[model samples]
Target: MEPRDTATRYDQIARWWQSQHQNSSYGIAQLKRAIQFTAQRYLALDVGCGSSGRFINVLLQHGFEAEGLDISREMIQLAKEQHPGTTFYTEDICCWIPPKSYSLISAWDSTFHLPLNQQEPVTKKLCNALEPGGVLIFTCGGGSINGEISGSFQGQDFDYSTLGVDAFLQILTEQHCTCRHLEYDQYPENHVYIIAQKCDRSTSTTPN
Candidate 1:
């Protein structure tokens, strides 16, 4: 399915999403781990950021000027209302150009919804959008081979795709970013998260 179709699907359940996750602690620890790798907290972007504003709140609390983007208009509307002072973009990730580089970009449970072929290019795009010392934190279905699967959330069906672990590592290397951490956080479910940092030539190549 196209990204806009996913947006439409999410639009149909925006409030249900917020109501379910508004007070949840779901990605907090992982997000904070990614935050520590960023050398500068100047700017952060939450991609595929839904209506809950959970990640946005974390970014702001960590002292970054945060922005959020989602393809769903309803999701962006609620996010804008909840985070009135922050910038929100309602656009497709594949078609939208980042206006500026970010120090920390969190895709969280997003990105995997892209059509299979768009996976590598979008990962490259996000890697390119990072500053020299920036960090990218994102989630993907884990395995050694590329694949796509269907899943349901809040009664709405959705698709997820991944380029697999090796491809992701190769892409990060090709983009000049180093994979700082990769974990199958939900062991049996294949839910994996990765933290990668853009190499900083002026400093040591490892996260402090």
Candidate 2:
């Protein structure tokens, strides 16, 4: 799908997302782990942050300056209402230029929406936004590229071109980031969680 179409898709689903996932056990557990794994109290950007703002709230509670950007205006508005103390913007993740470096950057389930062709550049930008030893946590379905799935909220799709644990590690390594931790397991619903840390230059070397 084209970029604008993708944004519109999420915009259509924003309200349903807030209502359905607000009390999701899986969602809460993931946010909790993300907060606990953050190594420093610095700026963080929640890319594709949906209406719930659960992860952003967790970051704020842990003393991090958190900001969120989502393609859906409806989602951003809801997030603002729920989290007035934090900043929320209605912008596409692929086009949004983060204002400053972050110690932690999370994409959550949002990355799966990007077309396979756009994933690499977006991943590179996400890595560049991180501080020397920053962390990036995200999740995706475990599978190969497939056709779109239309549902009540919107048309959902999967592009494994940028999915899976090994592909995630390769992207980080090529970006001069280190893989400090990785966990691969299919939850009951077959989602995979992949977490990695940007390497500290004092310890990692870049190619000349």
Candidate 3:
């Protein structure tokens, strides 16, 4: 699907997104791990942040300055209501420019919305927005490219055309980001969790 079309589709489902994952234990665990792994009191940005502000709240609770951005205005509004003190903007992840480098960038379950062709550029932009030692934590839908899978949520059929773990790792490596940690085991129903650190440009030959 086109990027705008994907944004519209998500906007239409924003109200129901939180409810769909209200009882997800795995989701909870993933968020907790992301927050714990951040381990920085510096500012953080949550890209493609949906309606649920659980991760944002966790960051704030741990004394990190947190903000979020999403393509869906409806999701942004819901996030604003849940986190009035924090900032939330309606912005496309592909082209959004953050005002300052963040200590951490979190993209939980949201990167799956990007078409495979757009992932590399977006990942590169995200790397540019990270501070010297910043970390990027994200999850991608897990499946072989040729696999067929479908699920229903909010009266719409959700399909998976995911990149295999190896292919996904190649994208990161090509972007000049090293994968410090990765886990993708629960196949057919799994998502890849990745933690990549931004290498210091001054100390290294490349700009991360």
Candidate 4:
């Protein structure tokens, strides 16, 4: 499904999601692990931040000025209510532009929802939007090929896609990022997460 369609679908269950994840530890541990690699805490972003405000809270607690972006109006609305002063956007990441460089960016379980064809460019955009030495943490369906799949959650049918491990690593290299870590966090499930840090091309080297 398109990001817009997924946004509408999430709107149908935004409140449900908020209630379910209010205290969930699902991605909290993983996010913390990713945060440890970043040396700067000036600015961070939570793309596809749902209504729970979980990731945003963590970022703020760590001294970063955090902003959120999600395509769902309902999700963004509830997020605003939970964190009044924090900035949140109601735009698709595929088309939304980053206003400034970030010290860290977390996509978590969000970017997997993008259309397959948009993955490469969007990934590159995110990497380019990072400051030198900035880190990016994101999840994807683990594999060695590119593909799409549909699944149901919260009574809503949603779609997910992946560029697979190799391709994603390739993009990171091309964007002057070094893959810091990669893992199949959920071994039985095809869930994979990657931690990448952008390097100063002038003083850094991309692996051959």
Candidate 2 residue-wise lDDT, 1-208, digit = tens: 6657766766777788888767665455655675566567699888888898777877787888999988878888888988898877788777888778998888887876777666777888899898887888776655554323333434554233344556666788898777654444454555666666777776576789
CA-only RMSD, every prediction: 2.5, 3.4, 3.7, 2.1
The digit string of per-residue lDDT tens for model 3 on 1-208 reads 5557667777788878766643345455655565565535599888877887877876677678999998888888887887898988788887777788888888887777676667667777887787876788887766555243456666665544456667767767766667778777355557677788776566677458
The order by descending lDDT is 1, 4, 2, 3
Candidate 3 — which residues are off by over 4 angstroms? 19-26, 36-39, 143-151, 158-163, 174-176, 200-208
lDDT of 1 by residue, 115-186 (tens): 999999999999999998999999998989899999887788999999999999999999999999999999
Q: lDDT, candidate 3, residue 159?
A: 48
Residue lDDT tens for model 4, 50-147: 99999999999999999999999999999999999998989999999899999999998999999999899999999998998899999999999999
Q: In model 2, state the lDDT of residue 11.
A: 71
Q: Which ten residues in a row have the lowest lDDT in candidate 4?
A: 198-207
- Estimated TM-score per prediction? 0.96, 0.83, 0.81, 0.96
How big is the positional error of residue 50 in model 1, measured in Å on the Cα after superposition?
Answer: 0.2
Clashing pairs in 3: none
Lowest lDDT 10-residue stretch of candidate 1: 199-208
Q: In terms of TM-score, how similar is model 3 to the real structure?
A: 0.81
In model 1, pairs of residues that clash are: none
